[model samples]
Target: MSNPNLLVLATGGTIAGSADSATRHDYRPGQIGIDDFLARIEELGIPANLTGKQIANIGSENMTPAIWRDLHRAAVTAIGDPVCDGIIITHGTDTVEETAFVLDVTLPTSKPVVLVGAMRPATAVGYDGLRNFANAMRVASDPDAAGRGVLVVMGDRVFAARDIRKNRTRGTDAFAGFPRDAVGLVTPSALDWFGAPWRMDETARFDFSADLPDVPVLFIHAGITPEYVDRLVTTETRGIIVCGVGEGNMPDSVRERLIRLAQGGLRVVRASRLGEGLVDREPEDDANGFVAARALNPAKARILLQLLIAAGISDPAAIQSEFDRR
Candidate 1:
């Protein structure tokens, strides 16, 4: 008979932004406080007993792995609370995918963790943050939303974290879920569903107590040099992710250097710079013990590699198996 208790974590983004005028482009993100943001949501009559906190007030571009660890710890503690039925995260669109991906693979709970954000400032005309926030509450309160890992809600579209990427710069429909359709749609009267539901919580192998290892991503281009590879190796970098031109292919010189590093016990992941596609193993990559990132983009591939290394799985074959997941 009681309403679901919701835990909302506001990590400043456009949803909490303030512009002097509705049409003005100049504004400050996270200028609005969490209580003010929730007050408007409550006025819309979203049926939940809301409890929240402002975890951070920076734009998503400034997101760090330290904050990610803090978020995971907060989420774990909140989910373990008997009074909390679900969780929502207000984040900036620029790096929501990365944050969501980290939480999706690290959190142990099946309770819904819905991340929502706006493409426009809260003070802007045609502001969509309130609507998106309300929809996030509905999705979070729904029992069906459980066991789906972390979900990103925006523009009435719902995407699983592992499959989501920010595809537009200014549009309300800024997110795109590649290699998979959105799991649900927020209709005027109901939440419509489609496809089978899957989550990474059951099989996630990670320990975030240790900070994400130093793993830099390299975007391959014409006339690449082996010197870049030499720098990382000499510096004792834990891992490297190469965003190659196509199907995860790098220039001949760079590929040779990557092979050399892999042979020398450095973990290397081959990911695609192109959007939407799997980077499967090539015969040559396998021969050199380089791991293919399969469907993961370069950024997400880097996140996974950090977890893999931190979890103490350094073998190329074992790391490749983790990336091969659907």
Candidate 2:
């Protein structure tokens, strides 16, 4: 059989950084090219025809909607190329989940798109970039990984892009668990892979950017006041995602105003600030007319709400059903 063609699209992150001589342990993105990064991987003796391209050189914090558009376009273009079997993206861990979610919804392909990143810089002692990159390449090249939509492979775990999150600030295994048993995990070595089986069909394929509105997510911290929600609602944002307290609970005062906005026809979604557990809908809270985000984080929830609104899905039952479908 011919070798699988894997496209390594490099978006600057700690994984692609190199130590700068001027500063002790200082790292810079885009300082190293994708070709050089792959050269380090060749030492592992994995047999795959690899090609590289540098799409950006900044940390993922700098990633914007425009950047997502560009990345989506790149993946779409590559999928059309006969030589390209799959695509692997090396990105910063900061916002990898968000980018992956966007691609998972937008990219119209069954080809594997594995996103990999490192919590520690390439210069750190026992940095995890090389191993993560190798494992991601292995996952991307696997025929079994196809038709799963966008996936994230880090610290040897495989997650569906829509459900993954950067749960830890500094850890090799930052992405873990799911609100539901929708996807599975991979072993430490790329030689073995396991998880809940996944299959994406036409119904699951969503037009990512079709009617996405400019929605901003606001996380409610301790001591949050009504003014915060008032400002967001008044800002004329097409949609708003409230990262509510445990179990998706919001302050009664804040909740009241959010309901007012919803009544006015503004899109509002309530998501959990806590990592795990489902958002419970209170009978009294149901009058707010806002939708519960279920298992999605504030950011991922925002992405979905934006797309759903853009798709003109306003019914509470339909939105809830869509979340359940995924």
Candidate 3:
């Protein structure tokens, strides 16, 4: 049997970064070209006909909505290609989860989509980009990896997009799986399985092809003033997501302002700033029409909200139910 054909989309991140000295602090991210990256992967002899496209060559910290739209279009076209059996995305770790979550929710393909990244630059002494890239390709080529909505392969762990979070700053094993454990693991010869995650694939959700509206996330802190909330109302922003304290709580002042905003017809979501755990709906929160983000982080919640609003979902209860399901 012929090996599966895989398409790799490279976006600039630490994996592509270069520095003169391996120990040097100063380096340039996304300095390498996609062709070079593919050539290195070719040396692995993974038995696949691999093709690559350089979608963007900038650090993922600079990831913007415009880039996201372009990437979504590219992924749709690539996945539709007859020769492409699987897809791999080389992205920066900074916003990797957010981008993966975006693709996971929007694309309904059964073929594997794997996202990989590195903590140290390609030029660093303990560079992990090459190994991670090889493993990402391995997972992509595995038939079992299909139907697993967007997987993040880093170090030796494979995470589901809906549950993965970048947990640390410097280690190669930066990503942590949540609520449910990792969906799979990477070994020397093959991809091993733990179990499949709860996926919303083919769930008849709306697409995010249009522009995402201006929905900003406000992180809460001790005694955070409600000035920003007041301004969002003044500017007539479509929605607001508060990364509230502990179980998605805010100060009394901020909560009151947010309640006012929710009462005035603007959508509100209470998401946890904490890395793990679910934010259940509270009685007071329900009274104020605040949607609980469940287990979604602030950034992911924002993306979901943007999609819901764009689809004309204005009722908080309906929106909360969507968040609950997805």
C-alpha local distance difference test of each model: 0.85, 0.77, 0.85
After superposition, the stretches of candidate 3 with alpha carbons farther than 4 Å from their true spots are 196-204, 232-234
Model 2: CA > 4 A from native: 21-26, 180-189, 201-204, 210-212
Please report the TM-score between candidate 3 and the true structure.
0.95
Residue pairs in candidate 1 whose N, alpha carbon or C atoms collide under 3 angstroms: none
Query: What is the C-alpha local distance difference test score of candidate 2?
Result: 0.77
Q: How much is 66 displaced in model 3, in angstroms?
A: 1.5
What TM-score, computed on C-alpha atoms, does each candidate reach? Answer: 0.95, 0.90, 0.95
Candidate 1 per-residue lDDT over residues 1-326, each given as its tens digit: 78989999989999999889999987788888899888888898766899988889888999988788778888888888988899999999999999998888788646889999999999899999998988898888887887788899999989988899888898798888977758899843478767555552464446665477788888888887988777666565888999888888888888888887788888889888887868889887778989899888888999999898888899888899889874
Cα-based RMSD of the predictions, in order?
A: 1.7, 2.6, 1.6
Which residues of candidate 1, in runs, are more than 4 Å off?
Answer: 200-204, 231-234
